[model samples]
Target: MKEEQKHIEALHDIKDMMNRSSRFISLSGLSGISAGLCALAATIYIWPVWLAVREKLRTGGDLQVYPYPATDVQRLLIMTGIVTFLTALLLALLFTWMRSRKTNTSMWGSTAKRLMTNTAIPLIAGGLVTYRLLDLELVGLIAPSCLIFYGLALLNGSKYTVSEIRWLGICEIILGIINLWFIGYGLVAWAIGFGVLHILYGALMWWKYERV
Candidate 1:
């Protein structure tokens, strides 16, 4: 019986080593939480502008949404989005690095590169598409589009990380699709997709992986 138990332990150890080598498992849940918080903050800050934008779009002439006579709201939201994205990215990197150190693993490796490449393709494509949408003033579809693309990116990259991210991706995609039915609530959808979902996923990851 002792010999059998020893063999089982060895198998488990080997399996763990293989997983570590093949996956970048050092991603911290707090990183997701921080990102979600930043998104929520940005959403709150822009809520009034969002209300104004949608209201105007609902009633204003169909020529355009903003910059016709030049307004600060358009620039404000763009700047906020840029800042929010950068802040979330920096925090995510910092948390991942910290976790990697704690786990005694290298943050950068072939697996990480693959993950980044897979995720970046969709994100870059999505960004370009979003730019075009803005250029055409199809503001209603922008939020849903972002959610879908981000979800796709998550799914693409989830192979190199925790399995739960795939579920998060699915949720994002579903939410984005649903948001399409409510075209006037782009910012609201954006907040829920980026802010609420990320926090939920992060909390789940922490509970599942780091609870010990």
Candidate 2:
């Protein structure tokens, strides 16, 4: 019995070492929750802007959100997106770093580098394409494109992180594709995709891995 137990313990240690080498396992669920809350706040703040846009499209007339001209609506959305993204990114990095410290893991290890490389490529490409879309005045497609690209980023880097992220990526991709059929409901899509999904995923992750 003692020998068999020793063998099992050895196998478990090997598995742990393999996982540590292949993945950045120190990510905290709080990162996702914080990002989600930021997204939801942004969504709430931008709901009025979305309503204004809808009104403008429906009436085919000049519209403005208070002192700004109709043309400024897109600019306003872009600014909001930038702020929310930066804030979320900052919070995510902070939480990740803290978790890495707690776990005594190297936050900037080779696995993390590979993960960032895979994720950043898709994100940078998406940002450029999305910018072009904005310049071309294809605002309706912006939400779906953002969702799809971000999904690709997550999926691309998921091999270097927890497997749950892959499912999140898949869900984001599916939601983006579905949003194509409901362009008028882009805000709704964003709310559910970025806000609700992140919160749910984070909560699940905490329950599964961080509960102790």
TM-score of each: 0.94, 0.93
Candidate models: Cα lDDT each: 0.86, 0.86
lDDT of 1 by residue, 124-143 (tens): 99999988887777767778
Worst 10 residues of 1 by lDDT: 62-71
lDDT of 2 by residue, 32-142 (tens): 998999999999999998897786674763222122236677678878988999999899999999889988999999989988999999999999997887666666677
Q: Worst 10-residue stretch by lDDT in candidate 2?
A: 60-69
Report the C-alpha displacement of residue 65, candidate 1, in angstroms: 8.7
For model 2, the stretches where C-alpha displacement exceeds 4 angstroms are 61-69
Query: Clashes per prediction?
Result: 0, 0
RMSD of each: 2.0, 3.4
lDDT value for model 2: 0.86
